[model samples]
Target: MEVKLHDIGEGMTEAEINCFLVKPGEAVKADDPLVEVQTDKMTAEIPAPRAGIIKEFTVQPGDTVSVGSTLLILEVGEQAGVPVKIEKNLPKPAVAELQAERLQSFAAVKRKRVLASPFTRKIARENGITIENVAGTGPAGRILDEDIYKFMAAAQQKPKLPAQPAPKEPAKRNDKVTSTIPLRGRRKQIAKKMVHSLNTIPHCTHFEEIDVTELITFRNELKDQNQTISATAFFLKALSICLKEFPVFNAELDEEKEAIHLLKDHHIGIAVDTEEGLIVPVIQNIEKKSIRDIHKEMKQLTDKALENMLTVKEITGGTFTISNVGPLGGSFGATPIIQHPQTALVSFHKTKKMPVVTEDDQIVIRSMMNISMSFDHRVADGATAVRFTNRFAELIQNPKMLVLEMV
Candidate 1:
């Protein structure tokens, strides 16, 4: 039996092998964990298809394979036969021609007038155009390779009704190649998601500085009592309270249905920096948890993320996200991009001992910090986002309010 890499969920097309759980000549049972592979989104354990002996491994650790590519060969239900051989990569022309022939045969079976080779059909499918609408210019009015390319080029060209600016000439560069790295695994996934978020979401960032002298004092008191709490826990608690008051901050925009969904559960995603990349692990029902509880859970989540042991559920379903750059040190504030589907993100920077004016107008030193808020402008206007950040700042500035609520 052959075990081919299949869909690993989240529309992932490829995966890199992290490690093989079973060795060659080892026997494995049906539904048993076989290979552990890592995609850009998450790490997954691929299970064996049937009970069999591991005959050969076609891929190795750090090697990336396509979605339908063979991962390994297994001996099941009979003597282990020779491993199935994979064919060579075909030339572009031959591949397109063969694809077109297959499409032509399918069109004939369906009794349709569409006369496209596989490549042409693929182009139409990718561009979301109907093949039947494309007029053929080849023999017998059949669609040719050139015909598909011409149609695509024509469709992509902008109209000449309005005068357009002259395009800039292409820049010349050194032809010698330096290095090439395969965009695979987590890095590739991050690139795709970041690009999509930037293109689709209109982001508005608001930066504000708050005097957290009292907040710092409160946290130090807790530490004196042998109860450790993280600044992230404080931020999460403040944001959760703010969300309760402003439901719009906790809402998700449904562009397809032209609606906004206000989520009741306060699942706050804490962005943790890992060696591979940044991953956000959500803490569910944050509104119901105390600062201590939030701190403990955040520590566990961070450890799991660093070790790459976080589950899929742990990494998803964040109503809002908080990215704390304080630990990195020497940073004041940063405008972070909104994690897609989520309307807002809050970034925390390092605390510094800066001079401040006292309530009585006396100059004094205080533990002040800067926080950056980023929101999807489509869902929230500048005023709304400002109000939300102001409210969050108010909560942080008044540390006594949080202490009273916890009591």
Candidate 2:
């Protein structure tokens, strides 16, 4: 039986074969993981359909195969028919050619026995470096991505032929060699999305500063009660409320239908920065969830994202998006790119203590946080964006208002 690659989820068209878990002639029971494949989003293992001995692999590690492409052949009991004996009838020259071909195939297989993931191999291929030539420093002599980079750097530093005596002229600034990063995998995907968003949507960003002194105090009180909730949870709840009031920001423009479709459900996506790239995992139906529940779920999703273990469902169907770069220590503001098709995205920056003047002309220190909200100008105007954020600020400044709005 031929084992073919199938669509795992999210209409995946192609995937790179990471590695084979079982070797040729190895016996595997039903549902045993046969090979690992890496999609743009995550790495998954293709399992065996039934108990069978692995006959041969049609594809190799790091080879990108489309859906329905043959991955391997399996030899099930009795159905695999007996091997034909055609070699004995062949002429002398034909037999010699067949033997030589077998030897070459064996050598090729032996050379590819190095331990490495598909991503590591991709980096090596992009840099024109051979995986076998690079030394592995990982567990059980696995070739890591860093090893491939180190090999390239060392190769570049090798001494070349002696240069001719230079004149009094100095070298040009552009003559220096610089390292290049390969645009592949997740980074490539992000670039494509960003370009599409910029080209298709006219984005307008509005910046605001909110006094979070009372909110910080409220959080400290919660910590004393042994119930801790993140500030982002409160922000999400407040945003959901504002989205209900200003439905345009939570809508999608259907150019074909010449109308804007306002969504009733609030599925918010939190942008997480990982070593691979920015991954957003959705928190569905935020309007119905409490701040504590949102905080718990947000932590779980962020952990999964950092580990690159999020499923397709966890990353799709986002009505709105939020990026909290506060923990990363950027105190100012940034014009965050809106997730395509979603009307708006808000990014919260670092908070710091600043002086504030009260209504009674009293000066005091307060915790102030900056936020940048970017919305599709075609869908909503700047005034509407400002009003939406103003309501959000009001809810956040008074944490007690969130309790009355909770489900």
Candidate 3:
């Protein structure tokens, strides 16, 4: 049977093949990873539809295959039969030249000696670098273009003596070559999502500087008790509580249906930056989870994200998102883009000790953090967003609120 590229969601019609996990004659089980494909949203491993031995791959790595296009041929179960060739609709004459070039390039790539993909080899050629010299960092030590960039960066960063004279031969002298990296893989996916989110979603950002002096104090107390909880865990708890009052914040917009999806379950997505790119893995039912629960689950997801082991289930179904760059470094605040379909996204920066005025009108030093929320103007107005932020700030400012539920 021909294994065609099935519907990989988020309205993605085509995907660039990244790597094939199985080769011809390789034995595999149903749902086993057949190939990893890079879509506009994420790089996901397409699992096999049935247990079979791989017959052949119609598409190679770096080739762009559309939905319903033949991906591979597989012999499934006991009886093996030749795949029946189905007639496909002829493409327009305008695209014939482009398609021919793509096919020619793919065929030429098959004759290359380098282990790197055609795209990676193209980058190497553009930079006038030998593909054999560049070390591979990807699986099976396959040379990736990123490894080339890293190599270039390292070479440029090397200190040279000011008194050193230039070599007589033009080719002998070491000079830096500027290379242009074609945005592909995870970075390209992020770029598409960001552009779409910004263009489609009319974002309204509301910033708040919360005085978390008491919250910090309470967290420190918990740390002493060996019940270490991150500030993000507390924030999640507060945000989940606020979602109950502000359902719009936790909703999804279906512009096609001309309706709003007010989700009851608070499946909050936490944006995590990894070596590949930024990804949000949802923690299901945040409303029922306590501070400890959030902390534990967040850690597990974060570790998986960093390791590039997050499953499709973990990356989808987020009703809302939080981007906490606090641990990364110091930042005032960031207006994070809403994780579309979801109506809102919140950003939390590093907490710093700054001077603050109490209700008694006395100035004192307090632990402060800046929080920013970007919500869809269509689903929520400025006033609604402000109210939600204020309520969230109020919960975080008062340690007693979070302390009551601390495990």
User: What overall lDDT goes with each candidate model?
Assistant: 0.75, 0.81, 0.76
In lDDT terms, which candidate is top? 2
Q: After superposition, how far is residue 313 of candidate 2 from its true place, in Å?
A: 1.7
Candidate 1, pairs of clashing residues: 40-186, 99-118, 100-117, 100-118
Per-prediction TM-score, please?
A: 0.70, 0.73, 0.72
lDDT per residue for candidate 2 within 276-380, as digits (tens), equals 678899999999998999999999999878656677789888999999999998898999998888999999999999999999999999999999999999999
In model 1, the runs with Cα more than 4 Å from the true position are 1-14, 18-25, 30-32, 55-70, 78-182, 403-407
Per-residue error at 77 for model 2, in Å?
A: 4.5
Give me candidate 2's TM-score against the actual structure.
0.73
In the range 1-407, model 1's lDDT, one tens digit per residue, is 77998986645688888666667766556676677777766777778787666779999988988899888988664322212222369787876676565445333332233544433454555555566667799778977545666676788832122122345555559655444556655666778778888898998898888878878888899899998787778888988888988889898999999999999999998888765677788899999998889989999988778656677788777889888888777456877988888899998888888888878999988888888889988888888877888887888888769867555
lDDT for predicted candidate 2 compared with the true structure: 0.81
Between candidates 2 and 3, the one scoring higher on TM-score is 2
lDDT of 3: 0.76
Clashing pairs in 2: none
Which candidate, 1 or 2, has the higher lDDT?
2
